[model samples]
Target chain A: MVLALSGAAQTLDSTGRATTLGLLGRIDPRARLIATLLFACVVVASHWIPTLLIALAASCTAMVFAQLPIASTLKRMAAMDSFIIFILILLPFTMPGEAMFTVFGFPASWEGLWRAVEIGLKANAVVLMLMALVGTMEAVTLGHALHHLKVPERLVHLLLFTVRYIEVLYEEHVRLKQAMKARGFKARNSLHTYRSYGYLLGMMLVRAMERSERILDAMKCRGFTGRIPLLGRYEYTKRDTVFAALMGALLMILIGTEIYHAV
Target chain B: MHIVDGALSNPVVVTGAVLAVGGVAYGLKKLPMEKIPAAGVLSAAFFVASLIHVPIGPSSVHLIMNGLAGLILGWAAFPALFVGLLLQAAFFGFGGVTVLGINTVNIALPAVLAYLVCIKGVRSSNLTTATVWGGVCGALSIALTTLFVAISLAMTGEEFIPAAKFVFFAHIPVLVIEGLLSAVAVYFLRLVKPEVLGAFEEVKR
Candidate 1:
């Protein structure tokens, strides 16, 4: 229970941190979003170490220019990269190739090591780009950007509504858990224990259902139609153009290297 | 169980994304106007549910509840699970943004299967039968999810076969746990608020 609540809190904190204004935050969200997608494609396509290194460098430069909280951002990046790191640690021993060295009596190979490094680089580059670009904007701003970008309306609304009520649902779950504990409920590997948890989740859904009725009624009373109007407006400026051009050039170069190697 | 970015080949990612888009469109079309808020709230429920980690023998596994989502939402499970995955990527980075399509397809498709496979038994008159079927739905969903994850990984390269196998073996306990929990949940709802099952009836029609 503690772990669950703490996870929710951590999610809130990290996202909340990203909403604060930064250099990337100043750019039109639409432009930043498009660039972020392009950067991800570039990172995924480019396998050359030099190009990947350049992508990493460019992402780092964006982070610095955004004036993001360096420590927290890196910490978040580390968390995201941890799984890949684990894979990297294991791949060298399992993958068949020319041996690099012996690690703890296990044969490590150059092929596996190189593959891990390439994947790690690509993963970090994409993650860092998102952190600098999409992460800088507020959730509402991001949603509006999607709305303007002609993303399906239902999806955009669903994303916003989910973001809006995630904390509320977390609090409700915490309360339900507390009530269970107050009644001396303990989960064991048995049918009775499973039944008790089922009651807990069922009760949550019941409550959420009732709450939704009230919310929908309230929205209707306020003259809300089916569509949510986006209040954010953006214009194309020199800054937007410059950012797009730089990103386009970088992606072309990355793709060029890949094609060069393939041929 | 989410797949991170840069983990999949381009062909796999593109195919998953295209399929996901189709699924979401179908889901939105089936969803009623009044039920839109319910979808959001349930998405939040799914997200929070995934945060609660249950300790097994050695390692802890988080609750997915995709089976529950599927049984309740039907085709709408596509959008509901999609929202949860999107928030997970955007907020905590548990999954990456680029792989959102594949992750959604992998997770939500199994859920829809669970709904199709177990709905009749879940709605049965016999209480024991209903509960048992609910358990099966829950268990089956996880089994299918792990299978999809494994397949996606294997498709990327032969090198990932071991990792794919590892994911399946690791989730053995999760399958049982979800089965039992979802059974209990279904039984409880049947007694307390049977109308909730009607959420998926329109989709069936």
Candidate 2:
């Protein structure tokens, strides 16, 4: 399990390699960001299974257009599913409706089952669209786009700084973990194990705090007057217009279908 | 404990979004120019720390450590933790986009509360005294977080009530683990460099 976790951590480090290599990649980050927000809101508001399935399809298409690795992206989506699977499985048994089946002497409702499926679909559709649109961009670019989108300057600065250091700190964590392993530290369900892990975390935080002091002095020396000037310029090219128009039309279709189903 | 998009009712999501914005704004207000780097680096540290999974009986749970975060960051825990969640959603897909606001509030509010409730105890000069307080903060934050998550789920629909109750009960072990880890971590910090614990107080003064 530790090996698997370390492997997962290694993959996390490579998120920086999410390249601007496809159709969605060439579109403006600001446009992509807005489109993703609109897409998520619309998808969440949707009720019909068919509409949601279509939304999921649309997101899958976005993933393809973004040139995201298919198996691994879906694996990430499945990982999220693992967290909510318990709640979803409980829904059918707990919710009141016509009984679909009996499990362990409990009746499972069709209505509850449908509700679970709806939630699962809505979640996947929205998450996939978000990953395809925003996750494909560089973290720094996302920060710049948020800045352009008029998210508060301070918040954006915080985001930029956090993004800048995540990889560095993650590496530090890996090194520390390696050193602990070298010392024959095997984590188990015991007080000693927990305390060791605690000390490990404390040591990391202390080092991070000390590192921040040096960073602050260096930034001050470089004349960082309360704000790091955002240096990237984003232009809405023809591709952006086409992407925006297409996204708007897709969203309208979703809303229209949902309204049509309601009325 | 991320409440994904579409699981929450519109009113719940909107309310959460509004509260989160207010919290982040306030947190940013308390964060001065000189302190941004400190907060940012520490935020990154917490983000990395969250990846550490401690073993239980047959399973393991990753650390949330929002309690430790609160003890160190104070009100600034709001934006710092929010940033962590945002990055998680974007990169890792642990949480969704639309529900980002509620997830932020659910996790970060408890962190801020941990700060308010346990800050004094954590700042005690004695090591054991401060360590116990850190455990309380850690356990208390997780308890509150689970409650908030359950409330969000139950508010969305009557059907979610059972699932909501289960969420809290299931996390009891995690609460204990976080408490133990936080206590020792605080002990180490107090022994090694007492300044980190007092830095927030210095800034406030």
Candidate 3:
């Protein structure tokens, strides 16, 4: 998991340099963000199997359009599924309906099984679409887009600062861990281990605080006026309009399927 | 403990979003402009810290450390943690986009509660008392967070009750590890640089 997280951080670092290279890279981020949100809401509201399958397919198509590495992205999605798998597994046994099978005197229900499947489809589709759409942008660009989308200035500034510093702090943590390893410290299930980890975090936090102080002084010296100016100019091009229309049409189809199934 | 979108009932998701917005608004209001750097860096540090997987009996659990965040940032922990969650969802797909609100509420609300409950004791002149309080804060925040998550799940439907209970019970070991780790970390902070623990106060001033 730690290695996986480090890989995620590395990806985030590379994303800054990899900007505007994919198929969706030309589309306006604001349009992508709004479209993703609409798609997620519509998909979540839809319960029909056909609707969900189409939604999942749409998300996969978006992933392909964004040029995200399919295997690795699906691996990440699988990791997320591991978190909720327990609850999903239990759902069948807990819900009252037609019994599918008996396990240790507990009967699993078809209705509950379907409910779990619905949740799985909805979650994967939304997260995949989100990654392919807004996640493909640089983190700084995302912050700027949010700022332009009427998110608070302070919040955007915070997001930008956090995006700027995650790598620096992550490196600091790695250095600390390496130093500990050099000192023959090994992590295990013991009090000594936990305490060492705690002290490591403590040291990291202290250093981070000092670094922030220095950063503040430097920014002040430059006469920063509390607001970090967002300089990204995003133009809504013909491509963006076309993309939005296509996504809108897809969402409309999803909603229509949901309503059609309902009626 | 991220509750993904579509699992939660509509009302639950809406209420969580509303509450999270309120918390983030208040948190940003309390955070002065000058303090943004400090808060942002600390938030990043926590984000990095959360990636550390500690060894349990067999499997390992990644750290949350919301208690430590609360002690350092106070109300600002809300937005700081929310930023972390947003980044995770975007970059890692660890959580869903629509359920971002409920996830933030589950993690950050307890962090603020820890801040309110343990800030004074954490600033105590007595080192032992402060360290113990720090442990309590860490344990308490995780406890509340798990409880909140369970409540969110259980509220969605009757069938989720068992899953909710399981979520809470499964995290018992995590609570202890967090408590111990937080206590020692607080002890180290008190010895090395006491002012870091009083960060929120300085920001307010």
User: Which pairs clash inside model 1?
Assistant: none
The models' CA-based lDDT, in order, is 0.79, 0.89, 0.90
Q: Which candidate, 1 or 3, has the higher DockQ?
A: 3
In candidate 3, which residue ranges exceed 4 Å CA deviation?
A1-18, B202-205
Which candidate wins on lDDT?
3
In CAPRI terms, where does candidate 2 land? Answer: medium
**Number of the predicted model whose DockQ against the real structure is largest:** 3
Each prediction's DockQ?
0.54, 0.67, 0.74
Clashing pairs in 3: none
Q: After TM-score superposition, what is the CA distance of residue A250 in candidate 1 from its true location, in Å?
A: 3.5
Candidates' chain A TM-scores: 0.80, 0.92, 0.93
* Model 3 error, position B51 (Å): 0.5
Instruction: Give the range where candidate 2 chain A is weakest over 10 consecutive residues by summed lDDT.
Output: A1-10
Candidate 1 local accuracy as lDDT? 0.79
Worst 10 residues of 1 chain B by lDDT: B196-205
Model 2 DockQ (Cα-based): 0.67
